[model samples]
Target: MCGAVKFEVHGDFDSFYLCHCRYCQKDTGSAHAANLFSQSARLVWLAGEEAVASFTLPGTRHQKCFCRTCGSAVPNTHIPGLLVVPAGCLDSELSRVPTAHLFTSSRAAWDHALGDVPEFSGLPKAT
Candidate 1:
């Protein structure tokens, strides 16, 4: 993370999902978005509140908050009594794992063969 934005989740998260919807894919610039949902978790920004910016997908409830400095995702209030946390943004370990994959029908075609590809400890050297 950019270190511009820091936060803590005080309560337990109730659900976790890897969303493959188009919006999520676009926002994350990946195949899916890993999100943790909580009804009671509190988000307390420790710094760079001024650098944090949030955008609600024009006509939908889908929203995203990120640090303008490095464009890293940050915790944000989703709605009254609800909070959505991008799993990648956490500096600490999660108490539990992702519960499910959502909107699989909309997942990218290239994403389906990812697991079958070769694995590397780090970036593979150029041929």
Candidate 2:
């Protein structure tokens, strides 16, 4: 993620959700977005705060925060009283687990039963 931006969440997360909404899929370029939500945590930028940027989908509550240099998804607090953090961007491991998969009706068909697929240590050693 280029590590251009560094921040900290100072309090425990309220919930975690794997979001399968179409907007989430498109923005993440994946089946779903794993996000941690908190209403009380404070977000403090540690470095490269100037590099943080955000985009909101027109007429919708959807928003994405990212590092402008790397385009990696970052925490968003544009929504009042809530902070949304992309779980993948965290540098450390979390004890909390995903509470649910939201918007499952929009989940991609190909995303089903992915645990059955072949596992790889690292890209199958590139063939």
Candidate 3:
């Protein structure tokens, strides 16, 4: 990701969720969305506030904020006092883990039994 946008979260997150809803999958183009929710935390944008853009799905509360330069997910406060921060956007390490996987019934079919898959430190060597 281009480092066009930078921010700091000043308070602890209330919860972290791996959301597996259909909208979330469309948002990330992946299995789920890794989001940290906070009711009291403050997001201090250090730079590129003008480059940050947001989109809210029509007729739904679901919203996404991201850096326009690199398409990397960023924090959003569209829901009034609640701040929804994409977990992957943080430069610092998190002490808290995901609280739960939401909407499991909508989970991707290929998302099952992922622990059995092979692991690699990086991209695997060519066959």
Candidate 4:
């Protein structure tokens, strides 16, 4: 099991996004990443805030965070309450439940094309 970083969902998930954008690739140190986008009011960090470290990219507002101890990416916010937890950071049960994939046009060729999940060349149509 991964280290615990607790939070509460303030609103229903607005959408789940699978980002194949270069920023996601660099941030996750992988081909792409899955994210749960929710309202900022829905998230609260219960512990381990001290172990989290974040970096802001040169031209983007997005900030990514990870655990300094284990090097596992931790959830950070785009707004308030909205937590972006790396899909791998979740247990098996949660990891399997992705809502959608974003930036599909930029996905790597070798990556398993998730045909079943909702996929968008960019962010999916709102709601």
Q: Please tell me which predicted candidate would have the highest lDDT against the true structure.
A: 2
Off by over 4 Å in 2: none
Q: List the candidates ranked by TM-score, beginning with the highest.
A: 3, 2, 1, 4
Instruction: Please report the candidate that would top TM-score against the real structure.
Output: 3
- Model-by-model lDDT, in order? 0.89, 0.94, 0.93, 0.68
Which stretches of model 3 miss by more than 4 angstroms?
none
lDDT tens digits by residue: candidate 1, 1-127: 9698888778889899999999999999999999999998888888888898999988898889999999998877857888988999999977797899999999998998677899999999999
Scored against the true structure, residue 81 in model 2 reaches a CA lDDT of 95
Predicted candidate 3 versus true structure: per-residue lDDT over 6-78, tens digit per residue: 8888988999999999999999999999999999999898989999999989999888998999999999977
Q: Evaluate model 1: give its TM-score.
A: 0.93
User: Between prediction 3 and prediction 4, which has the larger TM-score?
Assistant: 3
Q: Write the per-residue lDDT of candidate 4 for residues 23-59, one digit (tens) a residue.
A: 8887777777887665643456677777777888878
TM-score of each model, paired residue for residue: 0.93, 0.96, 0.97, 0.68
Q: Model 2 — which ten-residue stretch has the worst lDDT?
A: 118-127
- Model 1 residue runs over 4 Å out of place are none
Off by over 4 Å in 4: 1-11, 112-127
Clashing pairs in 4: 10-42, 18-102, 40-80, 40-81, 40-82, 43-81
Clashing pairs in 1: none
How high is the lDDT of residue 22 in model 3? 99
